[model samples]
Target: MDNTVEQVNVLCIKWGDKYGSDYVNTLYSMVSRNLSRPFRFICLTDEAGGIRDEVEVKDIPKIGFKDFDEKHPWAKAHGWLKLTCFANPLYDLQGPTLFLDLDIVIVGSLDKFFEPEGDFLVIKEWDKSDATGNTSVFRFEAGAHEDALDYLKQDANKATADVRNEQEYITQFVDRQNKLKYWPEQWCRSFKRHCLRPFPFSFFQQPRIPEGAKVIIFHGKPHPDDALRGRSGKWYRKVLPTGWIAEYWR
Candidate 1:
């Protein structure tokens, strides 16, 4: 280990029981294998028990979503809590911070993510025609966009009404500042949209990993584990057991 080498931050937030510690541990393991450069794997969570010792665990930041909590208790489930990653002083972590959702599976080298020239980078929503970017895998300098969080804290009611989710809110704010950039289309792929075979073909064939995909975003339904076992999470859609997921998802 060279002390002089610069270490970037790899961050993930785990607030609820929806995902367990195994998800964090597996992500850390995947990152360790694929990222050549030195990095800090940090998990911001409400409960850190059972997480691997190698990961630095920090409590999830509180952005004071009192109004939202009262009116829309469902807001928390909508990823509003992720805005805390933009807090001005994110517990001493700084520079080129990559925020990854717990559900994502890294399959390629992540060194290229920090090489991109942009103040903020995200995955363009494949399903949307608008400028909205998926929040599954996004990068920004730590402490650079506290305003996004402030906007939500100041008026949770108005913020929630304006945007459908946290990703939309952050995307609009960064785009307004002319700092939003998207990764190449092939780098961060949506498993549901890009991998799963369409309709009838999906029933028999296993999902294929897209070429050049560094991170596979399991945004909804049939997460990495579910896909591995051939559980599509829906009756109509069929996902055959994919053995390759075990190759990289560990």
Candidate 2:
């Protein structure tokens, strides 16, 4: 790996009460332990009460979209918060950044995500049939993709009318420019892939972390907490050592 950059910056977003501040605090420790380089861990959030003192906390930027202005029902869909990650390239931030979802638990080192060369980078969603990024983890220069926000603002509803989440809209927007790139295969894995023991096999099985995966994304239910409990509370008793998730919840 080239490792040419002076330092890498990490960013995560937290809004509303879904995820508690401990997720932010633990993530800071996890990332710090895994990446052995100079790095900044920034949390873009509305609440900063419980996060550890060592972590840098920043307010979630208002990306100037009307949807976010009025506090409407679909404010999140306006792509406002996700838009902040692109600000670095435009100089809103000082260096390269890897944006993460607060719900994720860092299981390994994130060094490889920084080494790849590209205008934009993200993890390939395992469920995607073609070139779709899961967006649970992604990296890019700030402000490099201002047009994505601009385009969404121009046709706010049209841009997000059908998509289910930010990853879909953002990846498609970046992909159109032919500049978006992805991390090496298997560097990012899905929690369902790496942590959960499937049904039928659930009675006796455990999640196998992929060999090269640096992060495992828990997109829907059966989050890290649920995985650690050895119980999704549904039909499958997907048991794994709860120790992994206990570390994150710390």
Candidate 3:
């Protein structure tokens, strides 16, 4: 490595009322504990009212959509398209950006993600088992993936209309690029893979955070609160390990 001590920037985006400032604060705390470097904790948000003290807060950079015309998820103002800072560089998004969804916890040191690998690095979807990117957490250079935004700009409504999720369109764009890369196999993982059990075995076993997993992502229903309580978000108790949430939240 040219510089063993890498200067990494951690980025997150928040908009509207669906989620509160607590998500950002918790993320900041978790990241602070996990990553050791000249790190920058940036939150691209509409309003910075309740954000933490150390974070560098900035307004959600302009995409020229005027906020009202953003896509469905972003128009919801909380989905995720708003967090795709690498798209246009409007927010002064710079350097190598590690875009993390706020609903996750940083359980281990994140130095592995900084190892140079690809132009754009994302977690390979565990379920799809293909190039499908699990965008819950990913990294890229700021304003680097302009084509991803160009696709939307060319056909704003159509680009995001058919797909039910934002990551779908973004993944499609990345796959076509031929420059997209993925994280080292073990650094990023799905919570279910390392945490919740699928069935009866779950009763006897706890989720096994992989040997070198850097980030455990709670993609769908089970959130940090749910995971913390040792329960999935569903009504019936599955093979979720008890006290996992207490371990992180405490």
Top-TM-score structure, candidate number: 1
Q: After TM-score superposition, what is the CA distance of residue 248 in candidate 1 from its true location, in Å?
A: 0.9
Model 1 CA lDDT for position 140: 95
For each of the candidates, the C-alpha root-mean-square deviation to the true structure, in angstroms, is 2.3, 3.0, 2.9
lDDT of each: 0.87, 0.73, 0.72
Q: Which pairs clash in the backbone of model 3?
A: 74-77, 195-207, 228-245
* TM-score of structure candidate 1: 0.94
Candidate 3 residues 99-168, lDDT tens each?
8888776668876777776777887777775567777788888778777766676766787785656666
The segments of candidate 1 whose C-alpha lies over 4 angstroms from its true place after superposition are 1-4, 64-72
TM-score of each: 0.94, 0.88, 0.85
Error of 2 at 79 (Å): 7.4
Superposed on all Cα atoms, model 2 deviates from the true structure by an RMSD in Å of: 3.0
Residue 129 displacement in candidate 3 (angstroms): 4.8
Error of 3 at 162 (Å): 5.0
Ranked candidates (lDDT, high to low): 1, 2, 3
lDDT per residue (tens digit) for residues 1-250 in model 1: 7678578999998876899999999999998998888899999987999999999999876555664334345656678778878877989998889999999888899999889889899999987887889999999999999887777777767876877888998998899999999999999998889899998898787899999999999987989999999998988888899899999898
Task: Using TM-score, rank the candidates from best to worst.
Answer: 1, 2, 3
Q: Residue 24 deviation, candidate 2, in Å?
A: 0.3
Which runs in model 2 stand beyond 4 Å of their true positions? Answer: 1-5, 77-80, 88-92, 236-241, 247-250
